[model samples]
Target: MSAGEFYYDQKVLENHLISLVPFNQDLHVSKLIHEVNTHDLLKYIPFPPFESEEEFIKNFWEPVLNAPGECLYAIIDKATAKESGESNAFAGTMALTSTSKENAVTEIGILIFPAFQRTHVATNAAGLLLQYTLDPPSAGGLGLRRVEWKCHSENAASRRAALRMGFEFEGIARWHRICPVGVSVEALEKRNGTKGEQRGRHTAIFSITWDEWDEKRPKIVALMERKY
Candidate 1:
């Protein structure tokens, strides 16, 4: 199989709690811009907080849109409805990138808004993504052999979430990449005469192989399917 074969006709994955659908720029971009501007949710992420809608598009959405072999999905809370007086149902975004068809591997990256954190939203969204990635093609899965979860080592919350979702801690990459200073941190430091510091961010890598998923799938399914 080729990369295109795996990504072709990317499907919508959903459960009782959340829905993972292919991100639509027109519909999602504005919502994302509002969320980013209103909250400091993107602080731990590599990119700086988006100051405007265009910056959000050029810096975040456009890259994912143009990246070949990458599938990005908007995380929607199934419980929320526009008629309920909300501007949008979107909660965050998750992605599968660095996919290798011959090797049957891909990496999962996620960003959940502050409003949705600590709920079952992240776990169920992850479970749905995992289900779609590991299940066989005939059964509507990506048929992947390995799925990776990598995060900044300093991100303890992310590490905990990965372990809870059944991804095993593999190892850490030191000085993995350069990341911008978060808005809050930068602001506090600027008040003390320091600013514009980009630092090396260490990354912790975790993974769930096909066999591991086979063992863990039932438990995850039960967890996601249970009343929330």
Candidate 2:
């Protein structure tokens, strides 16, 4: 199948804890701005900090929205009640990027806000994405053979989460890319006792192949179902 044929019919996904929908700029920009300001969600990645909503749109959102074979979704908390009586409040963003129809593979990138981290929010959101991506085309799924999760080697939390969710460690790509430390220079100095730029990092790669998914899916489902 072609890229367009495989990705054209994007769908909304949900479970008891969270809802995943096609990202809408108008609906998500405000919440995203707040998340970015309060949380260092994009620090490990190469993306620069967002200085304004306009820059966020131009540099971040638009690129993802327009990218071929990418499906970006806004994560919403279903249990959070809003003044508008809507239980689904924007929590963060996640994406299935670098999708290849010919290879039947994709990478999952997630950015869960601070309020929702260490909770079932990330687990459920990931579970929903995995289920959608690994399900066979005949079953209304991506029919993918592999799904990758990559993060900064120094990001212990991300690496832990990847393993906890059944992604196996592949290896590290040394000096994979230059990534910002995700903090102001002062803050970085205070925390690490050195200038942020002086510290270099590597990329840790992980993956859950289709065969592994068969074994890991149930564990993930059970984890998501547990009370946290």
Candidate 3:
């Protein structure tokens, strides 16, 4: 169930499932564009034989930062790590796919940096994302109605994360598509590149509706407060 490993022959579509995110970097609702981009963390997520950090950042970084339907964010430790002045860093990026021009339903996506994986950080970030996305914009939120967490069937870690954050499991889309595994040069493209005969695996979908989110907020907020 570890996100770090998978058992499928075709690379799970998780590779394509990057975390798109949003956050209140500043107090103003109009300042949402200021949210951080953590795509640089993807370099560390993949296995080694990894190229220099700079190269990895250059190639794979911007797609997450500048993605058409996604937003990204970084979680810094406030205090720097001992080895360098670099802030103790983790990724807490989420993607919100708008259901309409007014953006009523926003499907979410997320990923955590390897160093910060398997901890409260992931859950906290998810809670924040949910809170910001589903709350009314009048309350400085997005007023969204639905949020989704879709993962490759083989990415048990991601599935677990969604469940832990209280998202409801929907169904799966078999043969979703293919992408690279970790940083491997090998790509798992679909058979004939058609929806037909595609060799990809299922995308496990999890979702939370606005009402359930509203009902759950008091408990989630209390849990998050305890973690801080």
Q: Rank the candidates by lDDT, best first.
A: 2, 1, 3
Off by over 4 Å in 1: 1-6, 82-87, 183-198
lDDT of 3 by residue, 1-228 (tens): 111111111121111112222333332111211222223433213211224434333444333333444444444332223344332332344444433435466666665555556655666666766777777868656677788877777677778877877888888876554423332222243323444331334578898888887777887766555643
Q: TM-scores of all models? A: 0.84, 0.84, 0.61
Query: What is residue 69's positional error in candidate 1, in angstroms?
Result: 2.4
Which residue pairs does candidate 3 place in steric collision?
20-94, 20-95, 21-71, 21-94
Question: Per-residue lDDT for 25 in model 1?
Answer: 69
lDDT of each: 0.76, 0.77, 0.50
Each prediction's total of clashing residue pairs, residues at least 3 apart in sequence or on different chains, is: 0, 0, 4
Clashing pairs in 1: none
TM-score of 3: 0.61
Better of 2 and 3 by lDDT: 2
Q: Is candidate 1 or candidate 3 better by lDDT?
A: 1
Query: Model 2, 39: alpha-carbon shift in Å?
Result: 2.4
RMSD of each: 4.9, 5.1, 11.7
